[model samples]
Target chain A: MIAFISSFISRVMNTLFKGRKNIKLGLYGPPNGGKTTLANRIAKDWLGEEMGTVSAIPHETREIKIKEQVTIKSGKKELTFNLVDTPGIATKIDYEDFIKHGLSERESKKRAKEATKGVIDAIKWLDNVDAVIVVLDGTKDPFSQVNLTIIGNLAARNTPVLIVCNKVDLKKVKIKKVESAFPQYPVVGISAKFGTRIDEFYEALFTVFR
Target chain B: MLTLEFVPYHEIANLSSIGRIRKLLNIAKQNKIVLLEGRLKKEEEIELIKTTMEEINEDFKGIELAVIYPTKNDSGIFTKMKTNFVDMIAGNRLGLTIIGPASIVKAIKKDPTKIQLYTQELKKKARKKK
Candidate 1:
């Protein structure tokens, strides 16, 4: 009974406030999946800025960065929302792994500790976000537990999700593989680094959120 | 030697989400791979990951988890209804959950009907010549 009432109220609130300036759209995925890169792309496209710095090392964005009051237009419709770029989610964070990437032992340990906290923050943010864009690597297999757990959590929260397959400019990219992996959601392939097929991403974004 | 601990669904069915996650993490921290009879709810799975991240330290790295559930992809309507009935009665126990310490279990590759759980190989230090 309480569940039904809460769900009803949530739907009502979503209907009332969605597409307004207060909406929060979050970017989430596994580590090194180019979430910050896509976030930079979107922010630069509309807000004339970048959200956070991107690096080859994993867990570069170890905090929740938000760009407020960013507005986007598609055709005759325009939507304004806060773009939230969250830290990548990972199941494991070992200090040794960072050392393997050329960091000193102390730096590695520090990064590992921060990365773990970042993941916890990202998961907690699931409750606050109105919608999400799950960024995936097009060159890697998308059938991992991390991907499934992320999508499953979003589904459980009744949050609208759009899957973005990043890195389509690479020679080994396979956007179709990711699309097949998640046939239920709208998958857009774009190289956030090279800005390939990003217009289609914007079009799909409007359609999905509409 | 690897330790695989089998936990039936009923073992955790009565526990709260936090309790269940704690119990599983405790077991995995002991360097034992947990083979649970049923899968956890989506929320619980997320909570488990969150808790695991909080407990990561020098001794305890984290966890590698996987779930294998029976798929009725090509089933007819009658079969679908039967599966639904079973789920309703049994609380969706037609699956397996594997949780292992990241220190021990390297990776868990899962497909629809199979799971390949890779374990880390312990490296031995070189012996000095006498």
Candidate 2:
């Protein structure tokens, strides 16, 4: 009976202490900016979760998609990340999809607007987060307003921004200009679609977080 | 009303690390409107802005926070975060803050005369510097 009790108590303690420390990281960018694709890669490679849906349409993520807990290890350090993937930035949206998805269009629109506000919230989350990953499209001009604004805001918040230049495999994409543009910040060029830079991306995250 | 102009660091030749540091120190000394333009990701820009603000705050008793973006469409997650950070930092201080896009189209849409006057003053200041 004493051995049985000891085994039960040990089981409970093991369950409680087995998990790593959770680090909340938010994936944020403009509409259809490969944010989801990168999120899926991170989730699958680090957390062992199955890949989520990927769509070409903007605002594909109308709500926050969260993967509760996934453990990632770097050397002797272990961290559990509660990765939150947010909706893309959109000035306006179509209500039909929201209704079809079983949510009110009015409410969805409100949520969409709130999603923009979530960017601020995400920055504030930096106070608690270990690091943040900012995804960018390599195919587009790096000097665009959205990219600059996002980078500027992140700078103001004092959050460590890891610029992931995604979609590098595309024929039209060129990383040289992008690399030259933001010399002050660390940037990792990756092709999220084909998982070309997945290893390097993880190494960068570990370096930053560590 | 602190105005900041962000320029790509690589665009400026002979802009060594020390030169950039000197420029920042000068901006701090002048209490002038400063801008930080670069083709950075959201996180990189935010980190730079925050560090610069902290540096400015260290030198000046209560420096205002203002972020100028090139276009209205550029206003997104990062912009919202900037406003929130400004509000947070402004809460205990004198609290002068302005966060918006610096696009001509947006300015004209809101108030052409005000934007024109502002631009005129900037150009005049540039001429004086020249």
User: What are the lDDT figures for the candidates, one per model?
Assistant: 0.86, 0.53
Cα miss at B16, model 1 (Å)? 0.9
lDDT of 1: 0.86
Model 1, B61-130: lDDT tens per residue?
9999998876543357888788778888887477899999998899998766678989987553112222
Query: Which residue pairs does candidate 1 place in steric collision?
Result: none
Docking class of 1: medium
Task: Give per-residue CA lDDT, model 2, range B1-130, as digits (tens).
Answer: 4455544444333464445544543554464444444323344334433333333221232122232333323357897677567646643222211322221111111111122113213554457669
Candidate 1 stretches with Cα past 4 Å from truth are A1-19, B72-80, B124-130
Off by over 4 Å in 2: A1-20, A74-79, A90-130, B1-130
DockQ of model 2, rounded to 2 decimals: 0.09
DockQ of each model vs. true complex = 0.78, 0.09
Query: lDDT at B56 for candidate 1?
Result: 95
lDDT tens digits, residue span A49-164, model 1: 88889999899999999999888897787777888899999889999988989999999999999999999999999999988899998887787888999998897787878899
True contacts kept of each: 0.83, 0.13
Cα lDDT, model 1, residue B94: 72
